[model samples]
Target: MRTSSLTGVTPVLTGSYTPDSGGDGPGIAALRLDPTTGHLSYDEVEPLPVSGASFLAAHPSLAVVYSTNETEAGTVSAVTRADDGTLSPLGDPMSSGGANPCHLTVHPGGEWLLTANYGSDTAPGTVAVHRLGADGGLLEPTDLVVHQGSGPVAGRQEGSHAHQVLVDPAGRFVLATDLGADAVFTYRLDTRTGTLERVAVNPMRAGSGPRHLAFSPDGDLVFSADELSSTVTCHRYDAATGVLTALSSVPATTAEDVANQPGGIVASPCGRFVWVTNRGADTVAAFRLAGNTLEPLGEVPAGGAWPRGLALVDGHLLVANQHSGSLAVLRVLDDGSLAQPHPPISAPSVVCALAL
Candidate 1:
């Protein structure tokens, strides 16, 4: 094991685009986080080479990271980070069993990795499961679950598009947000075998386009960011049976006239608030959370264009702006309001930010 101090600099791994890239950029870049000011600075290290590293997830207990190469022939790669914060490839990339794999997350037990494959024009969306080696290297996918059906919208929902896969806090179930299907699918995980068994398909309003979801700290509530309709939906979560009942749905953007696409949703650490990122409006909307309900707290400028990813680090809210090629740092005030601390930092086509 490598021993390192957490005093001066915190390592941050960012997935970005390359020069001649089509989908965003090319590789995964390294960054340093100032623990004091919550500011980020590029580390000037050579990024780990990948085709279209869009979304990233770190192993819970290892110095390894996984990323989805969002392309027609989707692949997931494993990279190990050295003690000095440099990254190197761990193994050859593995096919994600579908096209345009966009998001991935390591299981809470660190024994499996799950990916959401946003299918291409010719293929249907799927969710793939891969076993993890003892050291966190990704093994070949063990199972691929193809989603059927589509939403009400035309052109956008011609087929299923699974966007994200997340394991519930209790580890009893895995939930996937299908943007094209307009629903959240729940699965009972066979932990020992590293496979998934479909338990439920919770449907949302047609055309809601549920892209990403976040669960409350208590695991009693779940919130989804609806991409097509620019709405946020709160659901009552039943951890025992993995059922989600829609409680309320509200517009993600305060302004009615502005066209907005909601990208990411995250609940506060304390479970007092929920935050969602708006792409077209370039704002982050905050909501006060009550028992199975949400009251709009307001929205603030994202400090950059096209906020694609939002992560909570320490006590700060980090927004990865895809179009602006920067990451904005905002302080999470005590009352759950956001306050911009420093100007946005440079990061080209940043889609995911993982703090270590």
Candidate 2:
């Protein structure tokens, strides 16, 4: 059964670091999206308590959602999502097995949860695995693997920083992006044991600082958002052997004299284009896909500052602006360019947007 709604209104959940955790917004918020005009507003002003809910992922087999507690002593929590889009705690939080966990994903089987702990400046990052119970609650820990490496970039690359983790579209491999190490790790997860086995360490440009990656619709190619160098790397993925081979790198924006850092990336559903968010440039850049080349289509103002994450809702692109504290809605034109449908709506310290 589905929750009744006002015509075509869509529900979206937002994750943020509360003022208690050095950010704006209260906590996890439920937002109403009017797709007809790309208008977004708060369904309610109040929030459900989940401290530092920096990132969120939905369960594949249940009405549950998981979030990373992005604190010094990292933790993960699960919540039961009502059909009306309200959220409630499902269970007590579980240790993430490392510090500052930033991203998480549910395995295709819906039996395991994986998290990437982006350790602080001195500590190395780690990837932790936890089993999932029948009712969608988190079970005991299975395995934790620590990453070790450093990139050419100073300060930001002094130690390993695992930025994002996800299962490949093929469901045969696990990929984690390490920003401090300038490498993307490939792993084979033991479904029965909930353990991870290292498969390959795909290296990127020395100082690129790979943060997140998105696979092409066909799953044959991948585009990585490099934070430190403000570039996107194209990789050819061999689904049969689970191998990732870097083909090329291109600037996230063509603008000059801008100190840009790209933090988010997504591929069009049609496999015809790729989009990346530039923080310093405060804009979203679109690129046309031709074989392995990423040709610059154009750039559009992000409608705020520090655009950190993006989510697609039908023909609209929703951008989370961390600093300016607003959600920018862009219409995806037929030619792959972006245009603002209307003024951005207010959303304080919004770091991640996940449309339900």
Candidate 3:
């Protein structure tokens, strides 16, 4: 087990894109988050020796962190965190059953680890459900639900590419966003049997290409960051029936001619605001909650280039500026707007931030 020099400061784990994934990065690293200033401390680890760990998720009630290897022969691995801030592999890596596994989430019950395999041209994107060990290790997969279909968009929409997989707040359904298919599929997980039952396939705009989704604080709605169209769409979620109905849509960034690809999205805990990161525009746009709809609250420079991932913690927003290889910090304002961004912290190909 390797440990970073984290003593007085609280640490936040970060995932990065490595050379294997066409990125120049140090794989996985540890950074610090200051509760008072809402700024990040420029402390990185002797980076964990993992490859293509482009995204990461922590177990809800455990000290284990999970990562998708995100390679041609996709794999998943688990690492346990020690009390002294050391992290060790829980077990040997296991095949993800498809290529380019991009996103994953631990079931609320903590019994399963789910992955969204964003397959390449030869492989179809699939959702794989793996049984979780008592210690949060990834075990054998119980199901691999492959997505099928294509959208009107060219190149990116040529095949089925599942980008993100998340379990609903209710813990009754698992929703996977397929950007290539322009659809969001809802599935009911049979915990005892370790299976996924396809419940609903909600279609987005013909070529919206939804990437990641965030639930409203109230859990009554889901906000999707549409990558191809650069729009944010609101969907009314029916928790009872596991159905999602598209309600409205708004441009992720009103900035004209930017050709932006909307990436990460986050909703305020108070339900007062929602923020979406625009890559090409290099901005983070805000939306004010007006009754059941959203009103544009303007945007702020993302503080770095290619802001691809975001995390909102304690009134502060952290943007993973992928192309620029840095992490930018933005303060969340009371009126649901963003203040000027703070200085960017260097981190090679930083793609995602997970609170530790």
- Candidate 2 lands at a TM-score of 0.97
- Once model 3 is optimally superposed onto the true structure by TM-score, how far is the C-alpha of residue 289 displaced, in angstroms? 1.7
Which stretches of candidate 3 lie above 4 Å from their native place? 1-9, 42-45
Task: Report the number of clashing residue pairs per model.
Answer: 4, 0, 0
Residues 1-356, candidate 1: write the lDDT tens digits.
22233467777878876553474554898877776688788776688878788888988889888999888878999998887777899889999989989999988989999999999777999999999999888886788999987988888898999999999988889999898988899998797888899999999889999999998888989999999998898999999889999999888988667788999888987889988899998988888987667888878888899998898877878898899888888777788877763699878788878887
RMSD list, candidates in order? 1.7, 1.5, 2.3
lDDT score at residue 74, model 2, on the 0-100 scale: 92
lDDT of 2 by residue, 147-231 (tens): 9999888789988999999988889999999999989989999999999999888888899999999999899999999999999
By TM-score, who's the top model here? 2
TM-score for all predictions? 0.96, 0.97, 0.96
The TM-score that candidate 1 achieves is 0.96
Q: How does each model score on lDDT? A: 0.86, 0.89, 0.87
C-alpha lDDT (0 to 100) for residue 183 of candidate 3: 95
Candidate 1 residues lying further than 4 Å off, grouped into runs, are 1-8, 19-26
